[model samples]
Target: MKKAILVAIGFILYGAAMWYYLMHGAQADLPVQFRGSAADPTMFMNDRQLKLSYDFSRIKDWIYFLSVPLEWLIYLLVLGFGISKKMRSTVKEVTRFSVIHTALYVLLLSFLSWILTFPLRYYSYTISRDYHISVQPFKGWMKDSLIDFWVGWIFTVLTVLVIYFFIRKSKKKWWLYAWLISIPFTIFMYFIQPVVIDPLYNKFYPLKDQVLKEKILTLAERADIPASNVYEVNMSEKTNSLNAYVNGIGSNLRIVLWDTTLDKLNDKQVLFVMAHEMGHYVMKHLYQNLIGAIILSFFGLFLGSRIYSWAISKWGKRWGIKGLSDIAGLPVLLLIFSLLSFVAGPVENAVSRKAEKDADRYAIEMTKNPDSAVGAFQQLTISGLSEVNPPKLVKFFLYGHPTMLERITFLDSYKHKYEPKELEKAKKQQR
Candidate 1:
């Protein structure tokens, strides 16, 4: 109990330090032209919008920081109170089959965690709705939540079965074996996500605007991406935010734009957005991200295995865990991995931000329409109510892409640098 208290206090202090940094740190400085001032009313958000964005961002950040500590505490409570042990015993009494016992135990554990964390999820939903960002109906939201719960359970059970299988077979080298199997498993999930999983929540179909579709295809052709179609998903029902992305591998690869994007931006702006998505493919960002994730998982799993062993050696009996192979010890593994993920988030986000910045540059060069690129980013900010320049710590931790201010400034610089050269070349050709 004292250990748990100490752990909780440590996490709370960490979260507090992060919050303080976000509130007090200097934000990104924009050029005078792009700054939100009386003279440049159209450049960025106005005073009221800025305030709202700041407030919304703060609330969201608080929820995010609080969630990790709360999750850790919940897992601690479950272990400390022997809830996981009770769950395992109950499942074992009902099934003699090992697989069935593991599945049942995982199901109960997932359900309990889901129920415990539901208030946070619902509060997040409410905040989105209240801010007019989410338009999903309550029933639809609950249905999606239930779907997530079940889908998560299915994967959790599979993973636990695989991990325990190796643990039973080779106690010393199970982590290595598990990591090996995970490589293909991770690839399989990525491959099937667009085809098998994504459609469960939202409908997707080929882009309906033939003219716009042709334009996007032209950009894809310019980038030498083997895309046969541009897909549009029905996202307006879920949120007012705008997004476009490239997902899947090989035949399942898709360039997807939210319907909200079409509703919000003009044709040229949409093309620029499409160009950005195509840049991900052109730059091989998907494969790069996949490799990075696998590498991170390798290190994370290695460290987690060591930590899990140490933890069990010290506290297994107290927590009713029999050994490292025991299914009841799953929460310890989860708790360890979660801590690793939290610690590694800033590094991960920084890498992602760099990739996004590269993609933005690719988009601008491909389209050669700085105005449209700037306008697309502006519309994104307006529609999403994004903060143009978030605090340094907030951007480091939460932003996976450059802030609107950075993107717009980049475009402005790109125009100044390249437009003159293009103009001179055109004049020489005329002569």
Candidate 2:
């Protein structure tokens, strides 16, 4: 009874703290730059051009309310209290319990999404099928689906074990342990991912067009990046988004260009697109972003350990689950991370804004065709159906990109900044 009262009090205090944080901001009085704004256009060579004055507070509120029931379902799943009536007490049983739950959750989510592909198939059919995105048929989709489920299971199961081990090892400071362990693993993922991991999703075939290949080669030379594999991915099996990316590290690094992008973008546009991804590559945004995540998660994990570790123990049985053993701990971590992540939303946005800014500047330097990049960004935003003008609060909490209008305004400012030098460089190149 006493413990229940304490847990209830803890919830109230956490709510109060979160409320105050949102109302005042973690640091509301800081300047726009320090506060993080996507309003600066020079931030990205091609940034999403969203309008700046629109507000979606009501919509966001509605979404927040909608999250409740779904969260409750997920909460139940994580705690092993939903579908299964059995509970585990031992560490090994807890680990198995966590893995089983994660697997089913992943499979369920994937299966449901795959089942929904009928409507999406027709809706996005033109994206790849019309453009020769892939020659794969329904069989291909099934194979890909199975592969995805297996891969997702591997990833989720491993992650669960890691989280469990960290919680066990750290005992008192599992949050700190989670951060330390995950950082290196996440960083290593940067190197191993594109080479060893991504091929599991789809087959990679070298772009066979000599003209296109030569253009890519020349661009690579000009960009001072090593000439390497340019592979086409089978995005045609589903979806219609044109995309390109640089993946892996060192000699393992390769470029995977979507057939859709190749179909839609001219060599110049493709170059601009590749350069943008290259910016992320050279800037090492992946690892840096992961580092930021780990840091924030550490705070979240610490708070979770302090608060829910006890509640989970006391009330875990009510839900037909074990105590703070790994299985039941899963839901607690999920809830804690979700809640605290949203609580620390501003800080995460700040990090993303910084990384994006760097990537933008890097893209400009790599492509030196700021005009094309700007156009590409506008089209990208349009294709993606992103809002141009989000509410100030929405932008503060959610937007990683400076609103599209802010982007254009910044670019307008930037074009003038580089006019003299770009003209000089163009003349020199002509010589």
Candidate 3:
């Protein structure tokens, strides 16, 4: 009774802290760079351009909001009702090798999850199609989904094996060991994702437009990004929405622009967007995030191990798992991890929003073209049919980047401290 009361108090405090954080912000004050009037011409959007009637967006939002809890419930029901245990037993009966059994069990759960979530996935795709965001045919989408399923399955199997190995060896300290091992594994995955995993989904080729290519390369050079070549992905084959990003590290590091972006944005706007992506690289946001992830995972894993142990003690027999090392206990591990991830989401997003804001500032400072910066954001807002202002709770939990309106207003507020080079030259001649 006492323990339960303490737990409840902890939750109350957590909720209070989150509310205060949302109302105020992670920082003492929002930086001058992010505060500004939305009335500037550079941030303009006419009513005709705005999709104020929120039929599709509302539906999408509800679907998203419901999906998280629904998925959590599914995980709980599967584990709580002994379905995961039965499946694991069957896998073990079929395979003599424990590794094979674990692999099969993880694959089974992955496929089952894919099947269960198919309806929601299809609905989202349908809505995206209706909104003219997604252009891929159903068959193409299905193919991509299958590929994603296998990729996720392979990774899950490997992760589960490593986790169980630690569970067996370290017992009480398994989570700590797992977290230590995961840092390097996580970095390796980040290093390879752009080079290996991405190519499986889309074709990336060097920017074909020599002029645009040169402009991007020049911007990269200005940002002091080494030997940075601009690569364009065939994003139009899948979606109409525009995007560009910098991903990976070392040999895999590169700037990637969506073909849809090239199709929609003018050269100047594209340059500004590329500059923003370059800002992430130049600022080493990825490295910073990697370090943050490592730190967060330590706490997450530590907490998760305690929760998993408590859960096993309460329902070990009913769930058919002897202990944490039991292969049948995969669902329990997943449940604990999922819950932790959901809880930690707001913190992660806070960090991400700060990084994105800094990147936005960097882009504006480097380009000295507030108009192009604001225009790019305006275009993105229209293309994505984004809400100009989201509810505080929604934004706190979901938004990794500031809203488009916020970004546009920030750019509109930019003030130069000095005259332009051309103006300076003319003034010198007159003198």
Candidate 4:
């Protein structure tokens, strides 16, 4: 217990220090031209917008910092107090069947976790609404929250059953087996998420504007992609933010645009955004990411199994856990996995950032319209209230793409590279 308390304190301090650094660190030195003076009012945000952006960022950063340590502490408390064991016992009294007992315990655990963490979720929703980022109604938010709860409960039950089954069957090799199972499970989820899960939240249909759809399809053809359709989702009903993405794999694959994106961007800018999504598809980033995730999970599960064994050997009796096969050990497993994920976040973000940067470059090269590419990012920043430049550590940990400043600068540099050649050609023609 003393060690748990010490570890929690350490995490709390670490989060606090990060929060402080982000809030107080030297701001990224964006060029004056990109900073958008009040008189010029260029693509960059003005002073007032920057102030609001920073204020929103601070709130979000605080929640992120608080949530990590709070979640870790909650898991620790659950394990240290044998709350999971108690819950498992309660479920066993209600159901004699092992599968049923596992499902009920997981349902109860999921509910309790939701109830405990709901305040943060609610605050996050309210803050987004307050900032004019989320337009979702309170009832709609609650309905979505419930859907998330049940969906999560179902998945957790299935995962727990699998883990415990392997634990009882092959105590030593269970981690390896689980990791192998996860590869197919992950792919299955990826394949189905676009067709099955996403529709539950938002309505989607083929792009309504034929001209724009044709243009996007032409752009895809230029990039040598065999896309048959461009889809648009009714996202304006939920949020004012803008986004576009490529999702799924194989036949379920899709290129989707948020309605807000179509409403805000012109045809050229929209084409640039679509080109960016195509970049992901053309570069096979999805497959790359899936392979990377599988590799990481393999190591994560192996290391977690080892640590879990060491921990059970030390405190299994105190925690009321019999062995690895015991469902009561779920919290211990969760605690270890959570710590591992937190430690791995920076590496994961770095890889994602690199992919995103490559995609951005592809977008410019494919479109041959650096101006529109710049415009697309500018509009995204304005609509999303994105920080043009975040602190380095914050970017390293949190950002999965280049900052707005970095993107715009790159576009500007690309534009300049061609402008000199164009000017020289015009001069020769005039002569």
Q: For residues 284-312, could you state the per-residue lDDT of candidate 1 as single tens digits?
A: 99999889989998999889889999999
Candidate 4: residue 96 lDDT (0-100): 91
Which portions of model 3 show Cα errors greater than 4 Å? 1-49, 415-431
Residue-wise lDDT of candidate 4 within 1-431, one digit each (tens)?
68877886887688777667767764655667666522122446677776777777767767776777677777777888779899989989997999999998888777877888899889988988988889999999998999898888889888889888998999889999999999999999889999999998889999999999999989888888778999999999999899999989988988899999999999999998988889998999999988998999999999999999999999999989888888888888888998999899989988888898899889888777777888788778878877777777668767888877777778766877665766788899999
CA displacement after TM-score superposition, residue 307 of candidate 1 (Å):
0.8
Better of 2 and 3 by TM-score: 3
- What is the clash count of model 1? 0
State in Å the error of residue 41, model 3. 11
* Clashing residue pairs in candidate 3 (N, C-alpha, C atoms within 3 angstroms): none
Candidate 3: minimum summed lDDT over ten consecutive residues — where? 22-31
TM-score of 4: 0.92
Candidate 2, position 296, lDDT:
68
The model with the greatest lDDT is 1
Candidate 1 vs candidate 3: the TM-score winner is 1
Clashing pairs in 2: 38-402, 49-404, 50-388, 50-404, 51-388, 51-389, 52-389
Clashes of each: 0, 7, 0, 0
TM-score of each: 0.92, 0.66, 0.87, 0.92
Report how far residue 217 has shifted in candidate 2, in Å.
Answer: 4.4
Model-by-model lDDT, in order?
0.86, 0.60, 0.80, 0.84
